[model samples]
Target chain A: MKNLNEISTRLEIAKKKIKKNQIKDNGTNAASLGKALKISTELVASVVVGSTIGFLLDNWFDTKPLLTICFFILGVVAGILNVIRSAKKMHKINKYRKR
Target chain B: MSLNPMHQFEVYRLGPEINLGSINLSFTNASLFMTISASVILFFLFIGTKKKSLIPSKIQLVSEMSYSFVAKMINDTAGSSAKPFFPFIFTLFMFVLFCNMVGMLPYSFTVTSHIIVTFVLASIVFVGVTIIGFIKHGLKYLELFVPKGVPVILLPLIVIIEIISYLSRPVSLSVRLFANMMAGHTMLKVFGGFVISLGLLGGWLPLGFSVALTGLEILVAFLQAYVFAILTCIYLNDALNLHH
Candidate 1:
């Protein structure tokens, strides 16, 4: 029936309006996903990169724990690499908004 | 016992391949089932609301609520002007929800539990949203990378990192759903196997565990769907607003 179609259309419109409202925060969630991924990747990268560096340093210095500590610190650096990058991007986004 | 818990993830070839000249049309069993499930639910909803009455019934109320819920999510995440996208968004939500819900049935395939399935869905969402961003802002959409309020020295490094992180969204989103659903279901199946094998004594404990896990899996089914929808809305927002 036309009335049924009509109701469906109106319902559709109402639905659209509601979706539009909820979607405004969707950017935040997407960014959150991005951050989560970056953090995870960075964590893995850090452990691998750090431990490798540590092992290499151990080979260089002939010391066990020293390279381990040093590489762990290096891993932290890589992790920070992701964090800072995301933060700066956020910053630019915020700054661009005011202008 | 199937040695490969993940043997269920295989893609099956189907139909006596239909040919449109060079293009072959073959659908997988997974695709077929998903479409069937979606159709069943879609017809159910369409029939439920066939009667146009001022005072709504419970089914109608539920139908209306789902509409509102999805609509609100899109509107809030993607902005009001993004209204044209409602049907697609609605379809996405319903299909996902149906797949997840269907997964709750005994001995049924959890279609979304496979990484390929989840990844395909996530990739579609990612590509759709990325295309929207390009359409809305052209090349300027890249501006999403440079965020505000950093000291002058650190800007360049930040942008590169942000871009890398941004690009990783589809994989992360897909993986989260795939991993959670797959892991939970595998553990459930394993425990369930234990329940059958252990007879009365050991079986009782696993039986209880299976019950608890089933309840949790149901919650997870809903949550994963919500997360997917919510993330889709966010991506839509970026396209509509370009947010940076």
Candidate 2:
């Protein structure tokens, strides 16, 4: 009975250690959720900021629609660029994670 | 008892409305919930950490788990250079987490569902990151917008694109949190109304959906808070390291 109790106690300790380690492992996975949520926001934000800046500049320069049109295109490019960079970062993380 | 789903979001003065000069400082349900969230966070953390034990109590375990979670997030996303900002990031995470979780309660208001609140938080991060970038790198912070290995001919265009992306950070960050919370809560409310109006026999379907959605929202509540903090870490990383 004493030996059996010792064995069971050891098993419980091992189980607890495994649980702790699992929690730590899960942290890295949670970050992917954050990454997924972020990409779209980054794209939308770039366009919005680009157009706002363009609209303001056009108003200041008294050139209606010209700057806005230019900025809108620039914003789209910027959004694409932002998305590309984040995707690249994600790729790097995935590679590291694989290792 | 009009069965209006939108009524859940209504804000009304809770006490004597106070106006200080040009500003209206009326206390509303939103403000009340914010206070509740903040206090709840404080209480949780305080009690959780007060007993420093090798073998933690359940409360201490929760406190420690959250601490390590945020710590790991910062270290992974922002690197050790962002350690000094841990308190700010941790507080932000807990506050948002509490607000989100508390809002899930029946008859509770979600402070984070509002753009004004999330916008303020995002703007603070935006301004802080910008200031940090400028202070750390001086004029070179502008280099953040200038991609490396670009041809001289395309430098100006690339820079403009970069600047647009950089400027979009706050709007995207704030809107993402606000929209997620707002949409989730609205969907829950809408389904809840269906459960009520349909009567018990017909209400089971919507009730089941409401149950599932509540579970999903709980997950989302935790996730949005994590995203908020992690993104802040990423921005801080960019500022601190000047990483492209």
Candidate 3:
């Protein structure tokens, strides 16, 4: 509920405390914070969907070798799909907000 | 040996290249794109929350949450002295959050996964803090390396160690974020690749792992962003307290 200025002011104080203690990045928090967290379900779906296409392509080309190519392309498509899905989610969330 | 995992850090060409200087800036690498993604998110957040009225909406709620979260962290860890530095801290949070979150996307780049991006942010903190320290304390800022209450004999040695450690903050700060992001993403990528290569015979296990891993990665994205911002808060505490 604090104003932006008040919030920023508190952060400045915290920054100083960190410096004085020689606060290293090690274990500042409970566990190491990393990208392993915050992954979306859509991302997992993307890869699965990509793999399905690749599996089908491998079957279609009458050669399993094409699976490799199909999978590679699928990966890119999946990445793009992730972006689209994320954008849609953001938009949806925005729509949900009122007032 | 195979290419260093770090070698994957270079920028590449994607579309018609444009020359800004001696270097061509076209197909930017994962790092550059992550930076752009962060900026885009910031832009939208700004647009969404810019409006102020009798009622607040979803974007406003998020914006408010982000603002208060940092503020509370600062108050709890560093106190009121952190006020002036909120903007920098906010930017850091957004940037790290974006990088970590975007990296969770399939095959998308994780800029924070590299040391360079994290280093840039850390360095800014270092330079900013150092300047602020000196500005506030003037010549007295030198006292930060020498703590009170230590035994007389150990004073000199302790002071030396403190200075060395103080100087290393930038490297440590940068590495913590970078290593976490990089290691997590690499594991995800490897597991993801396997989920495909193993065929149906072995695919089930890796697919299951991928789902769990993806869920974990999302949590991490928020965590890293919070950690990075909170650390910045801690740093601000030192400057204000002048306890050293």
Candidate 1: global Cα-lDDT? 0.73
Q: What is the lDDT of residue B226 in candidate 1?
A: 72
> If you assessed candidate 3 against the hidden native complex, which CAPRI class would it receive?
incorrect
> Of the pair 1 and 3, which is ahead by TM-score?
1
Superposed by TM-score, candidate 3 places the C-alpha of residue B134 at a distance from the truth, in angstroms, of 0.5
Score candidate 2 by TM-score against the native: 0.91
lDDT string for model 2 (A1-99, tens) is: 786788789989999998888745655655666677789888888898899999999999999999999999999898888899889988998899889
On the 0 to 100 scale, the lDDT of residue B117 in model 1 is 82
Docking class of 2: medium
**Model 3 lDDT at residue B15:** 67
Best by lDDT: 2
What fraction of the reference interface contacts is present in each model, in order?
Answer: 0.02, 0.89, 0.05
Candidate 3 positional error at A43, Å: 34
**Regions more than 4 Å wrong, model 3:** A1-99, B1-10, B14-27, B50-53
All candidates: interface RMSD: 7.0, 1.4, 17.6
Candidates sorted by lDDT, best first:
2, 1, 3
Candidate 1 chain B: 10-residue stretch with minimal lDDT = B160-169
lDDT of 1 by residue, B1-244 (tens): 4535566556676777767889856787677768777886888689668886676887888888888988987776567987898998888788878887887787567788877888888889889888888988899888887777887799875664455455556766677677767888888888877887798887899899989999878777766777778778767877778664
TM-score of chain A of each: 0.51, 0.73, 0.40
